[model samples]
Target: MKKRTRINVLLAEQPIGETVVVKGWVKSFRNNQFISLNDGSCFDSLQIVVDRDDVEEKILKQITPGAALGVKGKLIESRGKGQSVEIDAEDVIVYGPANPETYPLQPKKHSKEFLREIAHLRFRTNTFGAIFRIRHAISYAIHQFFNEQKFYYLHTPIITASDAEGAGEMFRVTTLDLDNTPKTEDGKIDFKKDFFERETHLTVSGQLEAELGALALGQVYTFGPTFRAENSNTSRHLAEFWMVEPEVAFADLEENMDLAEKMLKYIITYTLVNCSQDLQFLNDQLEKEESQKPKNERSAMSLLDRLQFCVDYDFARITYTEAIDILKKSKPNKKKKFNYIIEEWGADLQSEHERYLVEKHFKKPVILYDYPKNIKAFYMKVNEDGKTVRAMDILFPGIGEIIGGSQREENIDILLDRMKEMNIPEEELYWYLDIRKYGSCPHSGYGLGFERMVQFVTGMGNIRDVIPFPRTPGNAAF
Candidate 1:
């Protein structure tokens, strides 16, 4: 029983004339003499050459697309033009056979909508394989970036009684039977009898818990799954996604911005160096996709160029007030082209506005800080002018807000007033307020939606494509 070598390693090592064992699913069986095999190790597939005359008819018949096979072969220089090296199979073992008549995936192009329906099997496709590989690289870069900065990785609770974003869009975690639900004396559904003994929901963000860790430990980060119950069925929204949040004590808004900018550049640069092949494939994929669009709708820069731009240039920084003023006078708003028209000073910016700031006005990544107090969360530090908060959002070219953060309010009196004004109950988050009472300093943190980052890096248009088993509105299949 010879050990199998991954295609990626074999491709890189190029063990020419050496007998190697490889096991993978057959991507295609062409001309009964070649097998395009892949094991999802990388974007490229190994061409396995078969001797039609020597191979058994039954074994050859089983080499259909999607069939799993183990092959003992000699690695040699490829005779074909597409690949550099190939395998000359000496022995073939069929682990499983996929019937060509019933197999959903064939050797052809499939629509993204169709692929979403069969997401469990979509990973075998080249496009998704590249996406997921780059996804892994980006994820690794995130941890490595933080670890090098001496930040502690903290595991935050998935279920909590408090909503950190104050967005009121959270999935409730309950063990109570809904068919015959428990009720209180006032006829309201009683959550006190539930599993946690009170109301608790799947956490929408782990920033609050990470903040606690930061206040005590000086610096900390959390990487975990977060859920939202928002019914947004858009290209950018997801019901469940991963988040990367870093919190630093004794840090102000400027330090927070620096941390975010540095981290993003590091991650992008790491991916460019470590995952060059996968990035190139995805870049070509985006180029092909963009070619189908109208000339006016095409992106000015390619995917690789856009990523390099992020790493090469400094992110343009401006206050939220300045951003609002720019948007108000921009041709999109003045000419009635924006979907959400920016008509006032206090209005929240939409994705279109953010994209404009990045792609048109700044021509690079943009950071807009000091948001209006009323539109932001309750925990942000109130500015001296009393009308705004020390909040910031990092906007990218294709994606709107990739990261949103704030200098947390350490003053218990101000925090309580903001919470009350925002209708956030203090009793619900008493422990959060207690941190301020004890020894809270000027702590700041930001959350990067891991899937959104993956989407941005991989040039994926739909957020659903980047995440495996995407949990979107009304669609949780596999």
Candidate 2:
């Protein structure tokens, strides 16, 4: 016979009366007669019925929780209330032993903090298994949504000289010897002796390079890992994360918003249809988690309902100035509840403001556009008012500002002037300017932080819980 049939396949196929091989780690053993086994194939575990008379007591004692087991069994209709089928073991083999005293994972509820420390072993748990499975479904949905629209998936560079975000928070990639570094006569560190011959770092965003492809190929998107060296230890921030950036030629800010809204809906709907079981499990888990909180602190809607709410209603659209006006008159700003007071039109919005707009005021996703140019990047198109840019940010209920992007300034003269005002060297971005120099038409793009989206969709409180191996300020443990 084949090595073993995965529990997911066995549960779905239900090949009754046939002798099959099942191999997995034991979740629980009840009375030495019923064994619950999980193989990471699905969130549900397979129940293995062991006849106490057939198996020796010494061998049966080894089948403790976390022990690896292989069993030759026959599938039959289960008499259990919840499950439909189970395996009747004929023979059993212990692949490994997990002593109850030594094993870190006990057959009980473990805190997420504890699980984070043991991330390598956390995948075996039902909650994490459901999260990752849903993550996979969302990732596939992203590619499918773009592919259906004839968008080319662009692979942007992982290392480059340009600081795409212009934020100066980057992890340097240098091979120079720190102990005996080379210096010029001016006492400046000589980058000529470095590996790239100039300063280079891990990419912060792939939007710039994706634009190059979009201008040539008509439409393109880049989904890849991005790095940030900010020393933020908060639950909302990560040192390293994944991003999905899509660029389109001959498109404006309105078209970009439309694309983003459609894409989000598609992914949410796809997960609901394809990963129903996982979503249901996560929904129940979230409900139990929230039940412990104060009544006022609990979420108004469930996980599945929140997802469906996103798909059901259109995102509210407003200008940054309009949002400021709304906030300035709101109770939070008037009562001095906002951390950052909304007294001026050009002040940047904070998380509290964003949450109020999404969760309390509008009670839906909101897209705030035409932000002040000084608050946005240099690439955004300058509005007719000269003080604002064609920048847009999509704010979600739990996750603030999930997507941020703008229409590119296609005019070569304006682009160069903005670069000069921002003190960005023209020579370094010669390739980027060339796109505007030759046959430049209107183009727009936006970037979505993948992990933040996962947190929003899964109702996960901490961003670290959504990603498999979260890289935080002082934590990189596998």
Candidate 3:
């Protein structure tokens, strides 16, 4: 017998009347006659028609939801209304049996919170399956976009001696026992006795290292896992996530924004074209979810429309100072509607402010640049005005600040001064500064949280739902 054909391929190929084998977990078994099977390749499932009399009662009893089954059947037009094709089973094989009463997954609408608790089995659900499929497409498109732009994909180390963000929130990697840590003469825990002979932690961002690659190779990008030890237990934050950072040599802040805008559009367009079915599924799912919300709280646009808008229109570009001015003059700030009012030019724009700019003010994707230097990182290029850095943040509707980047400080003296001002150890980042001292030119890069991007594309409200197994504070199970 020929190997079992994946349900997605079988559904797409629709080889009518061909004898074939189909294998997957049972999604639904109706009256022990019609079996809905899914192999995870697509959102739709193949219907396996089982002859109630032909198949033994014992075998039929095992064809419950979540049970893995292999079926030898003939491809035929589905008599069902929703599906066009299905399979007529000749032989049924139970690879794995799942007790319907004991299985966590049943044919019903499960809450996102409950699904998260059983994340290991949530992949079988249509909602999560669709979200992850779109997530995969977005990730794939990121690589494709960078590759097409001739940017070399560079792999940066996960363990680093330098805190790239200067945030001091990094997961430490150590071999020393916590209970018996070695102590120096100063009575402090000695990192010299630990692994790598130095204190190291998981990387916060690959932008710093990718800058090194860009300086040498002209252009480079990194798509990898990043860690944050921040104890944020919110829908938007994840302890461990993926980031896409791209750096370009001889590029300034404007070019940086253009690249980011283009890359986002490319990835989004790619997902829209390639994953239409999945997107549609997610779009409908989102609409249903929104239907339960108050009429005033519903989104102005549907998921598909929101994604298409991102692709069809140009993102509005404004300076941070200009944005602050706009916010101050806007009704929200004037009426004290903002949670963190924009009363000054130097305060960091919170997510509420960003969403206001994108959703209320511009009504489109917006890229705000020239951030106040005091609020940004030390690596950003200080502007000619002496107050703001050459930093830019791309804000999207519904999801604010999807991309953050800046032109790097190319001058060694200025970079060193900023590092000192930020209290970052100069000795630890000596190698990073060497690039500036040796042969630095104008360079820029940005970091896009991969899950946030996925959430934006899929219309998933929670960042945890977009990632397969989200790592967050107090939750690391499976």
User: What's model 1's lDDT at 99?
Assistant: 94
lDDT against the true structure, per candidate, is 0.93, 0.92, 0.92
TM-score for all models, in order of appearance: 0.98, 0.98, 0.99
* Prediction 1 TM-score vs. true: 0.98
Could you tell me which residue pairs clash in candidate 1? none
RMSD of each: 1.0, 1.2, 0.9
Give the worst 10-residue stretch by lDDT in candidate 3.
Answer: 1-10
Better of 2 and 3 by lDDT: 2
How many residue pairs clash (N, CA or C atoms closer than 3 angstroms) in each of the candidate models, in the order given?
0, 0, 0
Which model, 2 or 3, shows the larger TM-score? 3
Candidate 3 global TM-score: 0.99
Predicted structure 1: clash tally = 0
Give per-residue CA lDDT, model 3, range 1-478, as digits (tens).
Answer: 4797887888788999999998889999998799999989999998889998789999999989999998998899988788999888999999999988899999998999999999999999999888888888998999988889999999999999889999999999999999899999999989999979998999999888899899999999999999999999989999999999999999999899999999999989999998898999889988988999999999999999999999999999999889989989999899998898888878888999999999988999999999889989999999888998999999998889899999999999999899889999888988899998898899999999899999999888899999989899998989
Best by lDDT: 1
lDDT-better candidate, 1 vs 3: 1
Clashing pairs in 3: none
Q: Which parts of model 3 have CA positions greater than 4 angstroms off?
A: none
